[model samples]
Target: MHDALLSALSTVNDPELHRDLVSLGMIERAELLSGVAHVKVNLTTPACPLKGRIEADVRAAVLEVPGVQDVQVTFGATVRQAAQPALPGVKHVVLIGSGKGGVGKSSVAVNLAASLARDGARVGLLDADVYGPSVAHMMGQGAARVTANEQRKMQPIEAHGLRFLSMANLSPAGQALVWRGPMLHSAIQQFIKDAAWGELDYLIVDLPPGTGDVQLSLTQTVQVTGAVIVTTPQDVALIDAARAIDMFRKASVPVLGIVENMSYFVAPDTGHTYDLFGRGGSRKLGEQYPLLGEVPLNVEVRQDADQGIPAVLAHPETAAAQALIQVARNLAGQVSVRALSQSLADLPDQLTVV
Candidate 1:
């Protein structure tokens, strides 16, 4: 019965952690007596957002086990503010961010997650863009809510084999967060520390645009492995991207590389290409730092994001998807720096410190 319970738990995942509850070391205790089974699950935070779903999953898994007649599922949590994986192996934490909105930061994050998942790597995405969480919309989990364990810690929502979290998961659509920096910091802190993010090869955090309080708070709280800057080919956008790089550098966070979005437009009818936002800005930025790749202004990319299926998953063979895949591969290779390094460029004596 013990083995049976463990087997069933293999299918039950801690949504935020993105790993099987059993494998994540979240299943604290499980037993079967006279065909009645009781299980206790643990979480990482006091106000975990995923308690309900955890109980339901535990109940479902135990009931499916043979000799389990009645199932009582309970939850618990670790006292640690941030729960690292039980194992001490290295797991990369990548922050996908931008200095300006409409640059497809979330789209890049989702597509990158899907692309990495396609390559068989364990991946998780966090919609840290508190003021504008769209990972739910992009990943098709917008209506999905996180469940908590008995301790009331949050459980991530799963979709397409990727575990995800977003403010949208906690509240209904169109509801304002009405949260300030400290509140945002606490919420994000719990999201990282209290939620059980398990044995992941890559944990992608989709941050809000600009170098704001949330981004600053994240750098101070979570030991981010790296960062990815998203921008367009426009000069104005590049200027902001530079500022973002400076901020990350100030915080001692490494920048993996830069991704240029809406780089160009290709005419569907005549097979002609247009540099919609002008060209060379990304190349110039890449010259200063490392340039990952440029994503074209493809309609399918936008459509896929709106449809809750990343372009990489929805159209793997398309040019847009192929380009994103290459970017993902490059990003996967960038493990040495934490995103700040790659994006930083030495400024003139006067502007250097700022």
Candidate 2:
């Protein structure tokens, strides 16, 4: 019965991953008794949007097996962690930040990480937004826990081809974190030093809005490659964006560029564009820095995020997803340029005979 059940389950696949659950190590156990089969499916995160679909698929597959009169599908999650490194092997650490709240900084961070992973780059996202970590929900791991390995190092959870660590995974859902500056600093430090990030091409840090303890802790903890400031095309957002830029400059972290999210909204019925938040605000800010790219205000982006699948992965053909991909490409190019420049700077000078 177990063999038949396992074989049946092999036919069921994760919709997002497009791979058989058995092969993906999602099926934890399958047992049968008195013509009834009980199956346990372990997901990467607890808040998986496709949980119903996955359960239905598994049940349908199991019911097809001979002698399986009843099928009971159970769900659980085991969030994995990486081993701690003496020195992080990440090539570049990009901080996604905003000066004020409600500017969609976390959304950009999640999509940027997804986009980079889609482009075949090894990416990791760290949600340093301790007060309100949204990466877990956005990535569908809201109920996932961060477990430590035998070495006492925290392991990052994996989703959408990216390894991520977030405060949401550490705390229960809707739990408020009340910590002072020193405590906040220690938590951020542990996230950087104790989490096993492995070797990553890019580790995207999603910082909480504003230039606060987390930002200071990150700068003091790790050598950030640069910062990607996110802002809407509005004066209020732009004002805070400037403060964020100044914060990065004061910390000596390069401002890679600025991304103008919610630049405009397009009517689906009439195919008309509306600059709901006003226009050229990011370009105005671009006078002092590079304008990385603009992401349109699209409903699909929000829906995909709620579904725990980033737009870049869920609907790559869409305009919004493509815009994000372009931003990722531009960001990668900037990183490459900086890396090459640093490599040259590290080289010993060769004296020439006069």
Give the winner by lDDT: 2
What is the C-alpha lDDT profile of model 2 across 1-354, one tens digit per residue? 777788888888777555577766678889888988999998644434466889999999999999889998898754222122224577678899999988788988999899878756778999999999889889988888999988899999999999999988888788899899999999998998998888887889999999999999999888787899999999999999999999999999889889999988889999999999997799998988778789999899999889899989999988888888878767765664454443344433332111
Worst 10 residues of 2 by lDDT: 78-87
lDDT of 1 at 347: 17
The list of candidate 1 runs beyond 4 A from truth reads: 1-90, 336-354
Please give each candidate's TM-score: 0.70, 0.73
Question: What lDDT score goes with residue 330 in model 1?
Answer: 69
Give residue 118's lDDT in candidate 1 (0 to 100): 77
- Enumerate clash totals for all models, in the order shown: 30, 4
Could you list the CA RMSD of all candidates, in the order they appear? Answer: 15.9, 15.4
Residue 19 in model 1: lDDT:
57
Task: Quote the lDDT for 112 in model 2.
Answer: 88
User: Top model by TM-score, which number?
Assistant: 2
Model 2's C-alpha root-mean-square deviation from the true structure amounts to 15.4
